[model samples]
Target: MLKKEEVKKVVRPEAPQYVKDVVEHPPFRVTTNTTLETLASYLRKFPIDVVPVFKSIFSEDVAGVVYPHTSLLIKSKKLDAKIGDFLNPPIVVKESWKIENVAEILIAESKWGAVVVDEEGKYVGIVTLRGLLSALALKEPKAKSVAAIYTPLGEKKSRAGFVKAIERVSKIFKKLVGGEVDGYVVLSRENGAVGILTIWDFVKSRRWYRGAGEPRPLFGTRVTRGESKHTGVVRVWRIMFRGVAVATPETPVEEVAKYMATTGLYVVPVVDKDQRVIGAVTVWDILHAYLYGPKEGREDIEVRKAIEIVVEKPTLETAIGIRPSKHVTGLRARDVMLTDIPSVNIRDTLSRIRKVFLRSRSSIVAVLDDGGKIVGFITRRDFLTYIAEKSLGYWKRQKGKMLILKEQVAPGETVRILVEEGTAGDIMKTNYPVVAPNTTVEEIAYKMLAAGTDYVVIVGEDNTPIGVVTKDELIKAFKERGRKAKVGELMTPAEIATVNFFASLHSVIKKINAYELDGVVVTEGNDIKGVVSVDDLALRPIEETLRGEKIIFFTKSGVLRKVSTGLRRLRYSKVGTLMAFDVMRPVSLNISINNDVGEIIDKLLENGVLPVFDEQGRLVGVLNKMDIVKDLARVYITYAMPEKVAEVKEMEREIKQS
Candidate 1:
């Protein structure tokens, strides 16, 4: 076992320095008297997200601000209106304030920009969220592995589950006190791909709900009939955006940080060579690294020991058979291919297609035929570009008449009208990038860059979409495999927690909660088949439950039952119709018990959990990232044993005498 002192003595290379000593962009001043046309022109000319609006140009004090959305509202209302009408109070931060604190305030307010003031209360500059991210990117954490910080998909998938998961993650994020993660990643059991569900996507979905005349406690108003109304159930699968950027263990922190800054991503999943999600890297993680460096010490031995005891002896791992691997090899695309890739039926609606795009969080998604064969594809930019161009063209053609029409149109109706302007077929591409399962990481990267896209479909011999690999996945996979240390010393030794494939979903949920586990292994007798968790439940929603319709079903004993009005019974209805086998995620990867410790840590950091197997290929134990952390902190070992300390002192004295 590696000693704490030895581990601490291993000096990490210093991160890239932050060169800029001051905020890059100074706050451009605008006045309340500034015309909407002038503000719009300024926005078009400048690469800024916001500008300070003051009572007068001569006044040094900022009155409020004008942003993109505010500009839109101004244009939609009165083009001649003054900027003051739409001004919102600015979130001002002192120049000396920690960037992390600034980030927290901005995130909470959903504001894109904050005014950085000097000690004398003079406006010095503006700090947009992206700017802070960019600045942080300059001094990112020393890259050890992406898995060290990536948040797991955990046991979350339903709307309620999503809400709870977000809340839970938010709480964890708050504790970071340096930066925040803005979204959650879901490894969809339904689709068999690692996907993203962002807070902004949720915000958009909330708007859709409000547009459908549903009462949302969070967003209190309803849209009028002229706008599109999305009345379907809001499932995680329907609204999640697809595709994610990923990083490997060896990838530099600067690379991940720069990507997040440029792309506005808050988190990036870390994957091994095989493309399995082992862990994730987030802005907060980077911030922590930036502020505190890698944490190690003999200083909080009690706290470390307490954590080790609690996490090392987890009841969930004890119930589930999981273990660590002995060796990690360079993996091919086949290792990460998602067998249950999501595809839209040819007959599906634009609404349905839109939902799929949101669910995948991918700019591009597969379109299928009636026979479930691949046909074409749809992309985010295609529809979005079409909408903006069409809207502008229509407004320009109408000229004066359009301005009148806009004045007459209700505020809620705007989005609906815009949505009605296009359909799935309008923006879908028939020819998209595709790759085979055996493709290497280098080849995949070359293909993606050559095709000028971040995502590609993985196909089997039959030319059907088996899975997908994104730009992020390729970037992360580039990190080479690691070695040193053994799995037995690193992995958590536990009996696998599992449920039969035929078990009810409710039973699965109950079991997971009872055991306080993220997921449970699905088994057929003594053989492990797959895994099931809360995310599966969140992704799979029963139609009857959403519609609140009466569902009559027969029990296995031939008994008849009717479920009406209540969601629990409705969920139970789904359970009666489908088994755990219906929602279980296929097990594609596991580590050997004799694998190198470095390989085990890499796996745990990136994958969240490691399924340990014995030499005979039998499942043995499971090791989670937390378990590794505890072990690293020397929580399980007695601190500063008296005999060992005395022996160390004697040895030191002998050396000194010599």
Candidate 2:
């Protein structure tokens, strides 16, 4: 007879518990044939991120899953698309699956959550990252404690002052680098109350810049400032996100972690008994302190490797060997094609084309002739390539031509390079990929990968352009299933390119153009704080500026008026006096690398980009929609259709010989 302690260790120590034992039963689902509109309604009405799709009303089997963003993307173009048309690869796990094994699969697959099914393949319940984290939080060591893990504000607490410009606070972040804190608790400039300031707050405060030599939007109209007034200044209060989540020195580590996870904030400021801002503790610190203990130094484990270690419970089988029963068929081109295609006219300017891409949140655009026929296609890559190879020379030549004796500037004055502008016709590629509405998903997949293009024009039988099949659309059509790519495979690693929130707006824009990226992850030294997109750069609000200042006085009659200080101040008032913080949406969505390609697509459809992080809560990379389309297209061609490709090549050879 074994003792109770020995029995407990033998039964549950090696392999903790099963996911089914801890899954939440969300009372919302739709059948396989649910209408797109109905699915959209359910998604909007429910708090669930994804609605599970069942095989039938009577069956317990889950056919697939649909998310709000995926539905919205489809309805924006194909209003008739069914829930079945956009179902993600079903991520069903056995009820007996160990929690560690289940978490491994979820992370490896890049899933938002998993649907736990019984031995009979009946849908039992769901387990999301929140649930997983909650479970993991319970396991955190409580003995060695919060004070050992958190960094004390110490002397810096008193340094938190008001009236500091953004430039000054940025210097504080630089000094606090690698000190266990990523943000500071700010003291109000006027009231002496404690506030919070992070690097992301600074990024959100960036003024809108619409390229050089373009008029900025004022009130509602575009206005150009005369040559004399250009004052560039960013004040601190303008950029910092005002509210702060605070913790007391004596609070438990588990309590802080729970708060951080719930709010999706990485750092929390610690306050004294009277609620004075003291120091802070970052997610990076808590993860290191709580998980590995204070003795262990931070290590850069590959996200997958990290998941395998932290979630290293004894498993009966590996995830790759787990074969699912269902197969996806009847997926059509029209079902996933984008009909709300952005088109550029031959007469459209370069600036206009740029705006279209920015507005559509797409990289490629079709250029149409007067007859509404697709003549060419333009991509950011094509324009940038052309600009890189020829624009410099063109500008130099144009400047040489424009500069004569009278037009020549004084010694100290720099000559403005006259860049030669062209119409959309100049840069658009004439050899655009084309496909018909009935084109098989495999055919478009192969062609997209082969051509290295993100889109193909979908035309009618009469050769009239109807819609565009983009990589995003094709990825949605494929329904990331058996042997699909992982989020790690598609994400742009943070180390290769990243932007700090403290980086100037000009610097960030330059990095975007330089890297040809839609956005860059805003980091506080390897820990991702948020992301800044090019689209976020336009139409941001600004309040105070060195260029000019306007005071909005409110009357007792409930009227607000903008009164300028003077013409000199208004004229010299900087272009960006106040910046809009909402442009940089918080980094709310994240998936582990083990998560699937379909999960990445769902997030991409929702946020235009998906942030990838490790199990340790550090942001690793971001997966753009184009990244999903281009990369998955290759994976589909390589693994999904290798045998079919060989057979087709053989048939083509035989026909040629005949």
TM-scores of all candidate predictions against the true structure = 0.31, 0.36
- lDDT by residue (1-658, candidate 2, tens digit) is 9999999867754322667655766556688677765655444333343467888888777787754345433313454666777778767788788665765675456554677778987677776544554444556443244555655555343322222333454345442322223345555432222345543333222231211233446688655565424343334555554334445455556655554433333456665545454556665445545445553332222110000101122211111011221233345578678777678998786656756765676767888899887788887656554443442111111111221011111111112222445678988888767888887665675576456555777888898777878665765665544236677766767753466545544445455544335566766666566665543332111121100111110001111112331111111111111111112445667688888876556666645566778788777777665454444344444455566446656766798999
Model 1: per-residue Cα lDDT at residue 467: 79
Per-candidate total of colliding backbone pairs = 46, 20
Candidate 2 accuracy as TM-score? 0.36
The alpha-carbon deviation from the true structure for residue 44 of candidate 1, after best TM-score superposition, in angstroms, is 12
Clashes of 2: 20
Best by lDDT: 2
Model 1 RMSD vs true structure? 22.0
For model 1, how does the per-residue alpha-carbon lDDT over 1-658 read when each residue is reduced to its tens digit? 7677666545532322221233546325579988766665555334354578777878878998766444433313555888888777888888787676776676567666777788888977677655665666545454333444334445232111122212333233221212123455555333232445544333233233233344334355555445434443344545555433445565555555554544444556555545555556666655545455443421111100000011223332232222322233355678654455457776665446556754774545667777766677665434434433333211111111111000111111111112232445565667667888887544454354335444577888988777777543542342244234566665544443566666654455555444434456777777887665433332232211100011111111111111231122112121112356545655656778787655444544433445678898887766543333323222111232234335545766798999
